[model samples]
Target chain A: MSAEAPPAEETIASPRPVRGSLPRRLVGRPELGAVVGAVAVFVFFSVVADAFLQWSSFSTVLYASSTIGIMAVPVALLMIGGEFDLSTGVLVTSSALISSMFSYQMTANVWVGVGVSLLATLAIGFFNGYLLVRTNLPSFIITLGTFLILQGCNLGFTKLISDTVSTKSISDMEGFPSARKVFASHLTIGDVEVQITVLWWFALIALATWILLRTRAGNWIFAVGGAKEAARAVGVPVERTKIGLYLGVALAAWISGQHLLFNYDVVQSGEGVGNELLYIIAAVIGGCLLTGGYGSAVGAAVGAFIFGMTNKGIVYAQWGADWFKFFLGAMLLLATLLNWWVRKRAEESK
Target chain B: MSTSRTSKASQTSPASRKALVALSDISKYYGNVKALDGVSLEVHAGEITCVLGDNGAGKSTLIKIVAGLHQHDGGTFAIEGEETRLGSPREALDRGIATVYQDLAVVPLMPVWRNFFLGSEIHKGRGPLRRLDVEEMRTTTHRELLRMGIDLRDVDQPIGTLSGGQRQCVAIARAVHFGAKVLILDEPTAALGVKQSGVVLKYVAAARDAGLGVVLITHNPHHAYLVGDRFVLLKRGAMAGSHAKDGIALEELTRQMAGGSELEQLSHELARTPAPDLSGGVAKG
Candidate 1:
C-alpha cells in the first residue's frame, strides 16, 4: 500500500490539473435532471405496464415524441438564446392548412403547396423576430401577438378557402404519395414500425446539440440569451442571432407541418391551439429555465421523451387518459426543482 | 501581448508617438439638451488618458461619441490622425476603437472561455459546417489570462462567479486580445472593492505597457493619478481642464472634479459638524 501510494500521488501531481473533476462535469450538464427523469419514467412504465417495454410500444412512444421533439429542439435553442415563440403551435397547423388548401384549390401538386407553406411559415417567424427586435417589446408580448394573429388567420383562411374549419384532403392529389413516403413513411425494425418523424427527431437532436456545443453560433446563442446588451457590445450581432433563432423555429414547423399534412391528409384549423404549451412544457421539463440563458437540446429531447412516456404510460398502466396533464404538470415541476438543485450543486462544487 | 506591440508599431512610427484617437471640439445635442459641448482630448499610444467627471458631467456622452454609439454633432474625430466619422459601434470596432463599458459586455452565466470568445469566436472547417475551434479558444484564453497575471481555477466556471474586479480585468484583457488600438473603459472600478480596484488598475497598467492606448474614465482622482499619463476633466458637459501627469497635482484635480468651491463649501460644513460633535459630546462625557 505504501509503495502504491507514491505512484498515485505522482499521477495526481505530475501533470497539470484536469479541466474539471468528473463529478463537476456531470453536475454542470443542464440535462442531467432530464436524463434522470426520463430514465425513471421509462423504468416506472416498464414495470407497471408489461406491454410498455415491447418494441411496438416503444415505437408508438417515439412517434408521439417525434412530432413535439421536432419543435422542442429549436424551441430549446431559442429559449437558451433568451426568447420564446408562442406562435409555433398555430404556425404548424397554419403550415399544414396552407399546403392542403393551396394544393386542392389550385389543382397543383402537393409539393407546390408544401413549398409555398414553407415560405409563409418562415415569413411569420421573421415577422415575430423583426417586431420583437424593432419595438424592443418583451418576447412574451410579441410572440403572444403572433400566436393570436396566426390562430385567427389559420381559422379565417381555412374557412374562407374551403368553407369549413378544415382544409380539403390532398391525399389523392399529385405528389401526395411521394410526399407521404418522405414525411410519413415508417421504418421497420424487427417487427415494429416507427415513423420517419422519429428519425427526423433524432437527426434534429444531433444537429441542435452539435450547434449548441461545437459551433460559434452556439456561443452567440448562449450569450444572447444570458445578456443581450453584453452580447451586442462584444459584437455578437444580437439582432441577426435572434432572427436566425426564430427562423430555426420556422423551419422545424415546416417539417412538422409536412408530416401532419401527409399523415392525416387534411388539417383542422384549430388542431394546434394548445400544442405550443406542450412544446414549452417539454423544453422546461428537459431543463430549460423560464428565464432563459441556461438549457441544452438533449435535455429538451429527454423532456419530450418523458412527455411521450407519460402520455402513453397512463394508458398502458390502465389508468384514465385524463391523468396525462396531471402527470405532465407534476413532472415539469419535479424536473425544474431537480435542475435548480443540480445547478446549485455544480456551483457549490467549484 | 508581444504581437499587439508589433502591430501597433507597424501602423504608427514610434519616434513621433502619435495619438491613436483624437477628438477636437466634439459636441452633441438632443433637442433642447446639450449632452456634450466643446470637448477635446487625445489618446496616445502606450498610455492611459483618464477622463474624470462627476455625475451628469457627460462622461457617458463622451464615451458614446468615441464608442460610436452616438455621432458627434460638431467638430472632428480622427483615427491615427486621419479625420473620420463613425456611424456605429461596428464601424468603430473596424477602426480599432473598442469600448468596455461598466457593464463589461460579458455574459455572466457563460463559462469564462465561452465569454472570452463570445462575439469573435474562432472557427475551423468550411462553409455551413464550420465549427468553433473550442480547444484553441480554451488554450488561448488560458494563455491570455496568464499574460494578464490571472490564474483561474477553472475556465469552465461561469464568469458570473468571478469577483467584480476579476470580471473587469477579463473585459480589459478581452479588448486587448481583440486588437483594440484605443480602449475606452467606462468606470470599470466604480463598483469594486479596494483590492479589486487594485487588481483592475494593475491590468490597466499592464494594458498600457502592452502598447495600447487606454481611456480610463472615472470619478476618482486617486485612481486616475495612479496610472493616468494625461487627465481630461469634464464639468457641465464641457471640458473644465486637460493636464499632463506632470502638470497637475492630485489635490488640484480632486478640487476641480468636485466643482471647485462646491467641494470647499461641503468640506467647510463637514468641518463645522465635526467641531460641534467633538466639543459637545466629549465635554458632556
Candidate 2:
C-alpha cells in the first residue's frame, strides 16, 4: 500500500521564503486568546483582592476549576466534533443518583454501584449520539430533549426510590473509603492542600490534548467538524466519530458525578441543573469555536481556570455573589471577541 | 448513436488490452426523472478520458457512479475487467479509485499535512501508546507535493490559504501517493481563474503521465482537447457523441459541445436583434 517513492534529491526554488517566526506561529494558535485572557484575569484579581495570591486561596480556586475542567474537556472535544451535549449537567446528577440509590437499595458495594452507574451513563450518551446521527437533527434539539428527560428522571427516580428529593448516604457502605480516596480525597502538596479532582482535571486535559493533536481520531474530529462532507468523501467515519465524542462527554460526566457523590456523601437530584452552561462557557472561553472544527484542550483548561478565578476572586474582594454571574458573562464576551479578532488577524497574515 | 460510437472506440483501442475502467450503457434514475441514460465510457492506463458537458448534463451523475457515491440503475461498470458495484467511497478508494471532488476535496481549516493524511493517517507504536507518525507524514506530504511541482512555503498553513489550483494539485498528489490506479476529477477548474485553470490542468496531465487512468470531467473543450485521448460528449442525460483523439478535430468537438445547431440558431437570433428603446422611454417618463 506504500505508493510513495523514496525521496529524491532534486529541489525546486520556492517563490516565498518560509515565514514561520515565533510571533506569527503563536498568532495562529487557537488558545492564544485564552492564554492572554487568563493572564489578564490573574493580574486583575491579584491587584484587586488581598487574599487572591495566597496559597490557600489559590488551591481553592484550583479545586473549583477542576470540577468544571473535568467536564469542559469532553465538552470541548464534542464541540470540536461539531456537536453538543446539553444533557451533561443533569446527566451528572442522574449518575450520582443512580449510584447512591443502587448501592442503598441493593445493599451492594459502592464499587458495584459506581460500575453500574458508568454503564447507565454511557447508555444515555449512546442514546443521544445514536438518535442524532440516525435522524440528522441539530444536536441542540436532540440534546435539549435528553436534558429535560434526564432532569425529570433524576428527580422522579430519586423520589420514588428514596421517598425524598435526594439519595441516602453511602458513606458507610463497603468500598466507600477507597472510592472516596479515588474521587474526593485531598492531599497536602508541601504546605497547600489540593483536591484530587485537580489531578483528574489535569490528566483529562493531557489525554484530550494528546487525542486532539496526535491520533487518527484527532484528525477525523477536525475533519468532521470542519468539513463533514469532505471528510466523508475521503473515507472518514463521520457518524462513528460524532458518537465517540458524545461518549467522551458521558465518561467525563460519570467522573464528575462520582466526585459529587463521594465528596458530599449524598446526591441532590436537582444539584446540577444549570452547570452544563458553565462547562460550555469554560470551553468557549478557552477558544473552542461555537461553530466547531478549531480549538484546543489547553484552551478549555485555561477557560475553566478563568472561571475559578472569577468565582473565588469575587468572594475575596467582598463583592456580592450575585455579581459573579455578571462578571462571568462579561469575561465570556470579552474572551470570545478576542479570539475572533486573533483568528481574523491570523487568517489575514496568512 | 451510442452503438456506432462504441464500435468506433473498440476499433481505435488496442484489442490486446482491456480497459482499466469501462462503462457500458450506464443509466441512473431518480424516481421518474432520468439523470443519466445509455452513457458508455472507457479509461485506459496512462491516458486521460475527458467527459465534457454543460451544467445539468449528467457529468456529475457519471462521476458519482464511478466514485461509488451512487449505483447505476442499469448497464455494466467494470473495473480491471471485473463487473462490480461499489458500496461506498471507501470501497472505491480500496480498489485504487480516488475521486477528487470540485469543492469538497479538502477541509479548508485544517493544515495541509493534516488534510493530506486525514482519513488514512499512519500510526506507529502499539496499543494505547500508538500515535500518528506526524514527522513522517509531514515530510511525506512535503515531498509528494514537491514531486507534483507544488512548492509550498509551509505545510502547516491552513489549506484555505492555498489557491484553488494548489489545493486541487495537492489533492491529486495525495491520490497518487496513495496508489490510486484511476483518478477521477470532478470539474477541477470550474472555480479557478484562467491561469489557475492552466495550473490545475497541468497537474491533471501530470497524473496521467504517472501511469494512472484519469477520468477528467469538465465543461471546457479547449482544456480537454489539450490532454484528452478520448472525448465523451453528454447532452441532457444521454450521450450526444463520442470520439477517439485522432477521429475528431478540436473545432468539431467545440461545435458539438456548444449545442451544435442550437448554438447556430441562437447566434442568428442575436445578430439582427435591435429592440425599441423601451428603457429609455421609461426613464424619460
- Chain B TM-scores across candidates: 0.89, 0.92
Find the 10 residues in a row with the least total lDDT in model 1 chain A.
Answer: A1-10
lDDT of 2 by residue, A111-151 (tens): 99999999999999999999999999999999999999999
Write one digit per residue (lDDT tens) for candidate 1, span A89-208: 999998898888888989999899999999999998999898888998999999998899989999998889889988887787899999999899997978889899999999999999
Q: Looking at candidate 1, what is the lDDT of residue B238?
A: 95
Candidate 2 residues lying further than 4 Å off, grouped into runs, are A1-11, A14-19, B1-15, B276-280
Instruction: Note the residue pairs that clash in candidate 2.
Output: none
CAPRI category for model 1 = acceptable
Alpha-carbon deviation at B106 in model 1, angstroms: 0.2
Q: Give the true-contact fraction for every prediction, in order.
A: 0.46, 0.57
All models, RMSD in angstroms: 5.5, 4.8
